[model samples]
Target: MIKGYKTQIMDYYEKIRYHERKALQERKDNIKREHPEILDLENEIGRLSIKLSMDILRHGNADDVVSKTREAITDLRVQKAELLVAYGYGQDYLSMHYQCSKCNDTGYIGTKRCSCFDRYLVKLYYKSSELAESIKTNNFNTFNLDFYSPRSDGSEKFSPRDNIEQILSYIKNDYIPNFKNHSVNMLFYGDPGTGKTFMTQCIAKELLDKGFLVIYKTSDELNKDLRTITFDNDKALEESLINCDLLIIDDLGAEQITDFSVTNFFTFLNKKLIKNKKMLISTNLLLSDLTKSYTERITSRLFGNFRLQKFYTEDIRIQKKSLRQNRFSEKTILNQ
Candidate 1:
């Protein structure tokens, strides 16, 4: 699309230049033939500006020439406005005289990037959304901390809501200055439906906004992909997974642990650690289960590298289901 736009922009620029040149010559010709005493300051300003620019280009020290060029351009602009009014054209006619007024149709702005270059960056970011989609589109704004209950009911004493809030605050503040400069690695371990995945997704969303590139993938999907390829594709996925700006491997212990997968997972983890790339992982299994499922090296690296947060809760799905049934029964009786 950008290439196509570049071609179109060039064509549009050529057309606009042709029209401006024709207008200028027609103005000069009319003055020479008809309005000889009208004092054609516009053409004189144009010639002075050309001379100034040439002088700057040749000398390579353009302080005076640049100042004079600015004055000449300003004078010609004022003259053009007066001429347009005299000839019954409006102020809007100036827009059609140049395709890009900022760069004056040269396609570059001063010494830095142009608006077109910025647009190309925006396009590149939009195209690079395969990983970003998992992060940006799912953020803390979409996370409902309210869903977490403050108490663990009459059974045992634990506070999931308080735990979640602490986790949330830690993630938000930790990323402010330090994580922005140096990335942080984390591990989320817990029972199923206890908000491990939820918290990891929230972090992914936050770090992405802080300008860290993040890739969120389940261990199951990653292992499957690795098995399908032999060499090149395998290397590419390995590199991306290990060395991305941030990586969140969700559902860690869920994949069937074959020898190839166990080796690959450890290798990926070790490489990320070596590079200082941050890794956040979530697992349904405890440390003991993890050790049994994966190798001792993988577990050791995980414990050594990541700030571990273990989630504890009765599955919220079950609680919500019970609540719904009781609510419906009450509503039916009230209606009766």
Candidate 2:
């Protein structure tokens, strides 16, 4: 990926140079054609200087010729400046100008990368993630607790809505204080339709916006990609996953586990734990389900590292439908 980015920058630099050269030549030609009077004055000055030097060389007493040459040079300089002002360029027209002045159209600076190159890498990275919609649609700003019911009359008096709101508040505050560093690994375990994936994506978007490298992948999709890994670059994906600022493993336990997958996952988790990188896991598996499906060792490691947020209640889909119907009925009555 890094090599590809470098090549891309080189290609961009070549294109920029091509266009700038064309523009500079066009500017020079246009000046000579459109301002013929200035060009004529410059040519006359050069001729006079050459003639005066020849005269001095032919006859050693040519002081008057030298004085005339000096006056002609000064007047030509003034004409050149006026011509530059008429055209929208300064007298330094020979200087190469670049759209990206930091790089001088060369997409790199010294041994390091240029600002435009860095921005290109960033854009490429985001494109590879392929989650622009997820980033745009899910964030702290779009998340609203008002959509959830606040009634405390169910079997669990303070409902799932209240529980999730508290979790949201804690997450917001946690990100504010420790987003730059000291972030805790989180395991959002719950039943389906309880907002586990939504919150995970929201957190991913927030971290990504703050310029963190966050890789978000579902277990099933990731497992499919892992199957194609060659003997070489075995560590490439693993390194990216473990070394990124945040790794979000969503829909865990949804993939059919193979030996290669199990081994790779264990290795990934172990390396990330050793490095203390934040890993956020969101799954529909409860602690009991996790212990039964995966080994106790994996479960122990997860519990030891992650702050568990267990979501429990009636499914949110049913609640959303009921709430929509209620709002519709109220609207009809108001119209009547």
Candidate 3:
């Protein structure tokens, strides 16, 4: 990941430098056509500066000679600015433009990363993770409460919609803001199509927009990558899984279980929990299934460290499909 990030930053710097050079060349072209003397003055200033440096190196009186040369360079710069202003251009028109003046198109300000560099990394991460596309369409604003059942059917007191609304409110108002200081992990378990995955996406999108690094992966994909690490010592995927601000493992029970898979899962989970990194896991497994599939220690850590939310509702996909079919049938009858 760091290698990829460095490569990307270098590409960005090259692109910016190219633009700066092109812009400066264009400005120089205009000056050559309309105000050729400005270029000549700039050339003279450069020559004088070089001569002053040579003189200082050749045993001239350092303080007095350097002060006189500095004054001459300052005066020449003032003339250049005056000429530029006379031609209705900014004084710094020929200066190289930078997206970040603090870093001058570099990714760092001294030893620290510039804010522009950080933002660039965040953007690159979002794009590489495929979250950029999903985040646009799956944020809190687009989430529909109508998809969840509004009324509880006998067994439950609150409706699925009500529960979801409460959860959303808590996440938006409480969880995301304090996430940097407090590590909170969540587990959403329910039947398929109960909006668990959608909720997970929603949270991921929100956290990502808030400038937190979020990684979302299905259990099958995650398992395959983890298992591959056993054969190859590549630790990039594992490092990202453990280190991102929010890790969302969707459809956790969908993976083919094996001893190695189970051990890696436990290790990954424990490492994140120990480091106080947040995670959100969505699975179709019941509490009983969770206990049966994993060891006591694994299940214990899950139950102890994660906030478990059960999504109790009918299959929303089926409901939506039926609703569409009914609408189509009604339209057909009306046409007849």
Better of 1 and 2 by lDDT: 2
The parts of candidate 2 lying over 4 Å away from their true place are 1-118, 128-130, 151-158, 230-239, 323-336
- Per-prediction RMSD in angstroms? 8.5, 8.4, 3.2
Write down the TM-score of every candidate. Answer: 0.60, 0.65, 0.84
lDDT of 3 by residue, 168-240 (tens): 8888888887888877889999899888887888888777777877878889988987776666765766776
lDDT, candidate 2, 115-176, per-residue tens: 67655555666666656677677677777565455765566657767888878888888753
lDDT digits (tens) for residues 71-122 of candidate 1:
7778777877776678775644434355557766545677754565334333
> Which candidate would rank higher by lDDT, 1 or 3?
3
Strongest candidate by TM-score? 3
lDDT of 1 at 74: 82
* Winner of 2 and 3 under lDDT: 3
